[model samples]
Target: MGLAEQRKTLGYSQEKMAELLGVDRTTVGRWESGKTSPQPCQRLALASTLKISLQDLEALLAPSQAVERGAGRPKASDHPSSGDPDEMIRREFLRILTVSGALTVLPLDEAEALADGVYRGNPADFARMNSHLWQVYQLARTKGTVYPVVRDQLATLREALSGARRGNSFPLLNAAADLFQLAGEVAFDANRYSNAAASYALAASVSKEAGAYDLWACALVRHAYVDISEQRYREAVEVLRAAERVAVRGDSALSTRHWVASVLAEALAGVGDLAGCEEALARAEEVQDLPEGSSNGGWLRFDGTRLAEERGARYVQLGRFDLAEEALKKALDQSSLAIGHSYRRRGAVLADLAVIGARHQDPDQVVTYAREALGLARASSSGYIIRRLRSLGDEFGPLSRNHRIAELGAEIAALRAS
Candidate 1:
């Protein structure tokens, strides 16, 4: 039987299943009707709730023969094979999570060895998988969806590390470092600052042990970001300075140093050091000279593409509304920001522009930008965007008394509550 038949056999109404899965009832309906498949993050829970193996769940969700024939859809075999490397990595990741519970009941040594043998998981495989997960995390509207898989991967990494021989340990340590940074990102996006801080600390520690200078510096930069987000500019500057020193020892071909500089500029601006902020921003702009592939795209995505927005944000922080608006408008015109490719970035830019409006006492401009930002926050379900909107709402000050601005604040408040 298909998903619908299976659901009925299990006596689960669509609403009941939706409630259990923490998804909308319509989402469940679409899954059963084959209009959509469960996301990677939803697959584990869906499989557990439906009392089926993940493989079986995939079968149920597969396009039916009749539908395939009617719609001229490609046959299953004609599609990417399950044996594809990426597919194998994903399946292996889920399998590890599924059996992790049972592993905990076994003797520590035996469990570690068993986990090691299960996949004989190569460091390269883990690295590739970690990269894939980062992409998934970036694209997912609900960043929290990545937590389960990331947790499972961390558990697996711990197991591998526990039983690893001395010769193989370094690579595994590198992988662990990379994964921890991702975990920190997921936590940071959720506004779990403490968790993010802890994760970044672990990442930096492991990266240092692995002698991966770039990774180590990147972790420090991320750790510093938590401080910047909390408005601890002095603390952030200390961390960023350490990161800067570490990055100097890393591959100059990479943009690690430049990325650190960019973030340092933000911290400087927060502390009202306009000259220092400008100097750091100029240093960051040197990233434009780096060759292609300067970034690994997973942990270090900074490529000069964000300079305009970053400059604008720093200007906003320093109360330079004229410079801020000019830079922010340029950033807004970028294809990714313009087309809403990254809701977080676009929302942040919009919020910054709204703040400029508040500074100018222009209620119309504030409402225009704030409204668009709020809509993006709601659509993306991004805590990062919500945080930006919250900051924008605070900027309204006396303008919050304005009818349109007050209404906008109310909607933002409601969104935060939800």
Candidate 2:
């Protein structure tokens, strides 16, 4: 579940949610964007609010499939009750969980030390810190509950970035950009769109200074998301166009430029410009022709199929039912596994399909897509998904008495009220 869905299901406004969750509004914004996850307590609270089991909430909090580790044989430790276990093994497992739980609430200095212990090398440290920051950002979306911790960490990271700049360290510059982007992500989760945009813009600039084209493109894409969310389609297109230009000069063309173009298509379609959307989509299609080894698997990891989902979303926006159905079907069939890891993404696809149904005045279609989307929205804790569901409900204004549509609307209303 996305943070936005959780907020909606719980009937929390971004600011109120932040206050209740003990976080700044910006932190909530980050969680919605998949830039972060909630801490254990926050997750419990979120689950309680959404009326989901803690186990289901944990499933939502798990890392996206994109970041899942490689498949390997199970360890002996995997069988907790195995007869081969030493007498002291269970105690150690409990101890580890206890320590890990305590560490989750540690202050910045201690957390940094633990991070250093967990990731000894510079590159490993970068990855580890980035991952933790992502998790923190996610948890921050629960509202006020996690704001103080994230705020302190961002302050520390900012200071570190400044120090690196003074030392003329390139890796530090890269790290600073990454950290700033993470901070921005947290801000976004809390619905602080302007702050999120500013931070991402700064990250893009710093990445450029570090000569990290992939990072720069990523920051720009994130910024575009902010614009898109605000329905500033023209502004979103302009930002994406800039990203496209920057991406062309980068090492990861297949992913970078393709993603930019795909987003541009969605933005254009949102503005009701079909021709522009089609043009951008065609460029995205061209991205599929890139060679297999073109992706570096860093930031710009597009392999063409990401655009498929965008195409479906754009067609939905354009009110092209046949085209939307075709694109959405293809998107569902070929989307990356990570897309399914977040209930929010799945709900978004369903929401798009619901819109298609609503446009055609098909009550059955609306019920089928909207109800499942509402369920997913509740599971994910995403305000944005609920907002989208509201849009779908609006589509029923002309057919309010339609029993199926009204039932779907009532179900969504109840979810939002929870």
Candidate 3:
């Protein structure tokens, strides 16, 4: 049975259990929620109070994924029985558990060091893995393909966070911030904006605690994307402005401040603030001089390579089809615009060109570009690409009677986003 079931089976409320165990009621609650495991001393008392052996208690503490309900015991008992040798071995096992348990509850560097001896991967490995995952995320056909990795990464990071000592917490905090941002990106890509917002907020809080200015700014900028994706242009502008202010306090070498400006450009264009958009784009250009190979390349991956696409998309919003066409075609020519590979980015450009076609009162060009984009969208299974095609479809209302346009509209409608 689950820990909560065991507690109730023994007729012990969390409050009473906490009092008997000399811990907080919330600690008991966390134990029940799988957020924490008890210390060895607490385990001894808990096993006695719940009338279970240590082996059964260990099974109860196993992570949900590591457990099997029906197959609870070993097929055959292999333990040595009632010998002095076996007793000595059990003593050593309990001793190691005691030290590990003490370390789990202690909030000091020495305790953390002792726990590190248990050989879980270090914080640097975590940061490096998260970076690679972000590259994979960008290159993945469907963004949701990255979630299982993100989820596992978050679980590992949570274990580290719960065991962190204050003196040794800077790396853990920074890692948490980076991982939380990655989690937010996965959630954002999946269109789970509420979960995305919460993850971004946690990242910002942890980054601030670590004095990680760039990480903090990135989180706030992501929070702004939640606003922008919902069409809250004015709110997004406010968020991006706040992020920019935070970015000013970040390292110039890292391009955090400039990246904020890049997002601000999109929000400004969304609101039809042409002058503001131009200024923001100009500010984002400063990233060219900052540095290279510095981005975390996972959550903080703003190198300004997509400026052409951003500029074209902004121009599309501004109704400057001539400028949009020139910029978007150039964007489509870059190596980043491969058909099936960079479908999300490439499809977006095609959709913009199709919009430009619609703007010019050319139904044939609209159907032509839109059809290619729809094909890429289907191949990629990208929700963002599908959304872009749907947006372009809105402009085809005037030409609804045109056979090809109507057919293209129906094709876009039939996309199942598998």
Candidate 4:
């Protein structure tokens, strides 16, 4: 029998199983759905609670993945979610009153001690660790590969929260807020928008409670990206404007406002507000005047380094190729060459240059950059990059009589099919 069948036979609802195992109920849901497996540390506990032999549990887990996710089968009507990771995240957090029983009930002294342990480490240590995770995230080929590490960091933060007293929550709060943003990034890269939104919302809420205004503003900006992804440009602009107000009240030592303006430029561009987009881009460039080393890289990655690409993308949106190509080509030069260094970034810039080339009626330039971007999208395995490539894919239809352009179109179609 599969996991659901076995759970049914034992008269255990998902909540009951999670309670007995003392883990998030979402973990149980993931296991039941074959979306994930129990970690090695938890396998014994899972097997014991299920009242099955280890071999039998393995048997159940192994065959169930195919039965559940091999496609060509009808999903349950009521569940309304098949394999979307965002649904898993939303249901998991939505179902929880708190992360775990221990967190909900731990004594203040114990929580204080846990927070104390976290505080014992230098705040810079946590900042650096978060910064490194961003570097890794940017360099990874498959972004979902970062999810496990992000989840483990999340568990650690929750462990501290379980033992934290109110007065002791400051440092823990910083760590939690930063890590939650990272968690959101991972979910976003995996195309799990609901999960990303939830994480960003929690990050903003917790950062506000902790009185970390810059962090709070940063979280709001991250949340705005979800709106942008859905093409709700007006909504995104609203969110960015709100973020701007919050950031203005934040610490000037941080580049929170500058980051806000950078994203604001993109949102403005999305709505075809050329003047607003240009103003926002100029505001983002104010970061260059901030004291050197303004970014901790954890919460503040925009240190004016991305302005070139941002400007290029904005101009592209404004249909001003005359201004875009210069900035985009510069962005391509400034982009990294390290192994697997987020080909998505380079791919995006290249894709934009190709679009600009198309607008200029330069088919050869279009094919040249488009093919390079397609290669990066293939190598990086980033859906975001592929989506950009697909935009160019559509524009190529008019040029398909050119065999080279036709060939490139076919390749993109093949990639989408795969």
Candidate 5:
């Protein structure tokens, strides 16, 4: 029987099932729609509710005869909810948290209770818990909620690296790389650029040792972002060049490498190296040469349409107002239709348009786009977005006498100060 039928047999509504499973109704909907299957815990709950054995639930959840031959089964284990590596890493991290006395921020008893949960949980459960904690960490603003855990996370990641270096095993090395990448992300979010760069470099080295080229390219791209943030355009160019080479060798058809190249072009443009910028842009544009759906989506995902956005931002830096305006507008339109949610990307492009408008002395457009982008950036809790806005606000310095522009500038400055 289908999941829905089983739910009906158990006399449970989607909402009810979701509540029992500690998930949303949409998750239950996905399960019933066959888009995903329940986790082992949820499966056990479902089986009990349906008066069935775990074995029976497993069989019922298996691919049906209606599935076409040679078509792969959508194994539940392959889904993000299932074999999540992040969960395991998080549990291990928490163990270090207790060991390092970082958990002292919480009541001793509460910390022990959490440690107990970590100890009892399976790897997937740990991963899911970690993922949830990270998400919570991202949205949470309290210093009490962040500092202790983040510090522990950093310590855990460092320990992983140390452990990996002591061992020559590929698994240990790969695990270290994964932890380092996570550490880098956390560090970047905290505006610890040097730490982020160091983590990315370590990740790249581990990736090389593990023979994982895609991971190496990803690390380099992350490192390049740090360089770009510092306005070290020459260093950025060098980093991107190395990243481009690694990306090409690893997976030329992937969109990420091309996206890396596109951003690299922007860095090149920052230095007034027009020729190199155009060439890098040309290479980035070549992502469309791959046949549709050829990308693995694991790495090398440069599908090319984001060029307008990149061009808009780059041209804004070059003071090419005309080009920036056209490209920025087009990017805004294209991004509106693209699938998925990237508040960061949307906010960035809108901020670029704002900068373009500011450059052209178009007060109305500047205010409209900048305010909108600022709101989105705040909603996304993006430090990078805030930094971009601050930089754009600086462009309004020449118009400081204009009350409206000055107000906008002051508002952005306030955000940066905070």
Candidate 6:
């Protein structure tokens, strides 16, 4: 029997299996569908969970030889295809992940030369590819799927840097900085705070070396998120303050400084500085006046589209439920959020609203918003949303005696395994 048959026979739903495996539900789906195989590190646990030997598990995972021969080896279509560009990018990235495994074992010089031949010595090509990867990462339901590609890209980038001439190294450094931030993002989404911090630190160092002030500032902002996630508000403020200083050196036309201020507002709110948070948020609002191309869509997407949610979140932190509810409801009215284009943003706003309900001791309101947020968390497989929901779950202490609230808490707790 196939993996899916085995799973059913064992009476394990995909979500349950995913929880036991510490992976996204989509990852488990891919394994059963024969679209991908588990990594070597994951195979032993998977085999044990399946109540099968490692050798038996491999047989189940292997593709049918007859089907393979009939269809021939899988390959990217050379002709132009129509679909979401992000989806196309994801497929291409998977292809690269497979090929890069072999390249990683080659000597550094040889790997560098091979990469150079592939890209024809143009750093812009690498930059563009990295940008696409970031878009794909943002849109992907399963964030861990991007890890192997990011890891391989970093390896190729290291080889490129080691062999580049000093005169041509700046562009490579800029590319490296950008990719490192994406790497940090993938790690951060998976709740690997230390690894994320390390990646962001490297991004900041490389950005400084490349003389890309905006990139450097953005890296520092991301680094601050690790501190913020751990509730080290003072430390986050210090990092963001440094980010603000560095952003001053970035191009005035860019929204780098304003983005720093936006994040700074969150940090200030964490420390109970209501006045400071409002001031920083006001500075962030000035980004609306900047030209259309003020921020790159990849690393710096803050174009005031998130300000409403940010304001609501900051007020929530300071315990101003009335103001928080007003702003968060306004945020939900925005077209993108109303349409549910961004599962992460919508999920976060819903979780925040649920927190407001908990604060008011309104069990029905809490359950309503929390359930919707939980649905988004499951659909998107977003760790950020899961984290917000976990915080919301903590606020359910007084309401937990309610049967519905207790069930909701159990569901949110299950995401911890995911």
Indicate which candidate wins on TM-score: 6
Model 5: ten consecutive residues of lowest lDDT: 74-83
List model 6 lDDT by residue over 1-418, tens digit each. 9988989999999999999999899988977876555754466679999999989987887653223334533333211111222222333453433333422434445434443442444577668667656666766666666776677666666767788999899988998899899999988988999999999999999999889999999999999999999899999999999999999999999999999999999999999999999999999999999999998877887889889999999999999998999999888788343532588888899999999999999999999999999998887778899999989988987799999999999999997775
lDDT of 2: 0.65
Error of model 1, residue 32, in angstroms: 11
Give lDDT: candidate 2, residue 227: 89
Model 4 residue 318 CA deviation in Å? 0.7
Sort by TM-score, best first. 6, 1, 3, 4, 2, 5
Model 4 worst lDDT run, 10 consecutive residues: 89-98
Candidate 2 lDDT trough over 10 residues, lowest sum: 79-88
- Give lDDT: candidate 4, residue 360: 72
CA lDDT scores, all candidates in order: 0.81, 0.65, 0.73, 0.74, 0.65, 0.80
- Kindly list the per-residue Cα lDDT of model 2 for residues 1-418, writing each as its tens digit: 5556766877888888777767788777766654444543356666776678878766665543122222232232221111212211222222222323433555546554544432222434544455554444443323323333334434444544454545555676676677677767656655678888998988899899888887788789889989888889899988888888788788753567777777888899989999999998998788768888555433444566566667888888888878888877676665445532345556777888888888888877788878888876766567667767877877887767887777788887876676
**Candidate 5 residue-wise lDDT, 23-137, digit = tens:** 7999878766656555432555677776888788767766532231223533322222223333323433344344334454445555445534543433232333344344434
**Backbone N/Cα/C clashes per model:** 0, 35, 0, 2, 11, 0
| Stretches of candidate 5 exceeding 4 Å from the true structure | 1-168, 291-302
* 1 or 4, greater by lDDT: 1
**TM-score for each prediction?**
0.77, 0.66, 0.70, 0.69, 0.62, 0.77
lDDT of 1 by residue, 1-418 (tens): 8989999999999999999999899988877776555656678789999999988988886664235344443322222123233322344344333333322334445433443443465676667667766766766677777776687677767777888998889989998999999999999988899999999999999999999999999999999989988899999999999999999999999999999999999999999999999999999999999999999878888999889999999999999987999999999899353442588888899999999999899999998998889888877788888888888888888998899988998999999897
The alpha-carbon lDDT assigned to residue 84 of candidate 3 equals 22
lDDT of 3: 0.73
lDDT of 3 by residue, 1-418 (tens): 8888998998999999889887799988877876445644356678887789878987887753242222342111111111222221222222332333332333344433432332264766556555555665666556665564466556666766678788887887887898788888778766788999999999999999999888999999999989988889899999888887888888767878878898899899999999999999999887788767656567777788878898999999888887899999899888354443367778899899999988787898898788889888876677777878878988986788888888888888888433
The segments of candidate 6 whose C-alpha lies over 4 angstroms from its true place after superposition are: 1-121, 335-340
TM for candidate 5 is: 0.62
Error of 5 at 171 (Å): 3.9
